[model samples]
Target: MDEIVRSNCTDRMRSYLESGCSLHYQNISNLRHLHSCERELEDYINEANAVLKKLQRLVEDAYDATLTANLSAVKVPDYSTADSKMNHEYHFTEEKQEQPADELDRDSSLVTVMILVHNMLKLDYTMQEKIVRSLSLKSSSAEIESYRLMWDLRPYVDGSVMDLAWKSCP
Candidate 1:
């Protein structure tokens, strides 16, 4: 009876050790899973930051184009002539005509629109290149799709629309 009791206790101890080992293995697996999740989250954040930076650059480019358009539209009208009398008369009238407030506003608006269009053109090119480069870099499908949309809008952004706008306005 004493021997039998000793044998039973030994068997119980072996089973307990096996159960503890299995629990330890499970804990290790859980930790590995957590680590993998953290890595994936970090990757997502980095991708988001890259996209945001690209978008900010595009906005800045658009703003610059608008400023250029406005400046170009405000050029003084040239009235030079070979006739001395006509030149004097032209100068006299030119000096008297103060730019109307509405004219100034119109000029500003036109400039803004032209600039916006130019910016769009630049964005189209930039986006196209970015998309191609990203594809080469093995970027995900979502990023490629975003760039494709920008690429498709390029034609309208060309100066032709702005030219038409000016023709229609005047």
Candidate 2:
């Protein structure tokens, strides 16, 4: 990889030097550099895509779990605990009533299930963080190298490489 990159850099530098200040040389150099780095770019994309696939599966599992919960007759309870000042809110007054014990149990169970799922998925969440962090490093390095190459060839062009990059994306 180093050999190929050095050779490509040398050849491109030679071409730009020989052509002097020419837009045609700059365009060709840009395109050639892109072609040379195509393999590396693809590899980075493949790695990121692998991570994305894992994330997608996790998201799908969460979606499926939610769907299953929704379909069940068992109702999950809201688990918001009463504050100190709101303790009297649970007290039965002449105009108020209390809920059945079973209903309260169901609500508590829902909170328990949610907590369990969160705990179980902690590893996946950590893995996701690691993947994204590594992917960002890889992406940043590629972008920096591309920018360096573009800057090296800047003198030969009338416009910025960003214009070309912008056009390619949208």
Candidate 3:
């Protein structure tokens, strides 16, 4: 790569000097210089791309090795604590207690309507829905709604408030 780059640079410099010394047509000389610069630029770009590809591969390999080492060193969690059992039970109960079909349908309909309204308002409905779903997965709808409302109103309140609200969310 270095050899190719040096050769191209030398060729470009020689062309430039030759063009600069030409007397018949100054415009042609300038055009020759421009073409030389363009060729040099293309050569440099190709060399840079090759170097970037090698760097990218090295980074990916390093990342994979680091991840493997870290994962191998990690200790599995002990689930003997009362807190862990209670947390498991809570999630199990929540899953076991199913809502009525009508209620489920109603909730789904409401979400669809909200998404439609949000899209009409030119807000990013997909992102909003993703946020809502992610939050709801980890907490109750009331908790998610409270945070969502706070996030929605943050920009209007103050810049600091908005920043704080964003930091507070997952």
Best by TM-score: 1
- How close to the true structure is residue 20 of candidate 2, measured as C-alpha lDDT? 76
TM-scores, all models, native as reference: 0.37, 0.27, 0.32
lDDT tens per residue, model 2, 1-170:
65765677776676765777366967889878866666565566567557656755665575566556545534533555435435565555313423434444554444444434443334444443344334432467776666555435533333433343334332
- Which 10-residue window in model 2 sums to the lowest lDDT? 93-102
Q: How are the candidates ranked when ordered by lDDT, highest leading?
A: 1, 3, 2
Error of 2 at 54 (Å): 1.8
Poorly placed runs, candidate 3 (over 4 Å): 1-24, 75-170
Please write out the lDDT profile of model 1 over residues 1-170, one tens digit for every residue.
65765677676566666686356667789879866765664565567557756755765675576556556555655545435456557776555545544555665566566556545655655555455445533555787676667666655366666675567465
Off by over 4 Å in 1: 1-22, 78-170
- Tell me how candidate 3 scores on lDDT: 0.51
lDDT of 3 by residue, 1-170 (tens): 65765677776566765677455577778878866765664565566456555645654564565545445434444657645676767776456535443444444444443333333322333334344445422477787677678557633234443454345334
Candidate 1 clash pair list: 65-115, 66-115
Alpha-carbon error at 74 in model 2, in Å?
4.0
In order, the Cα lDDT scores of the candidates are 0.59, 0.51, 0.51
Instruction: Name the runs in model 2 displaced over 4 angstroms.
Output: 1-36, 73-170
Q: What ordering of candidates by TM-score runs from best to worst?
A: 1, 3, 2
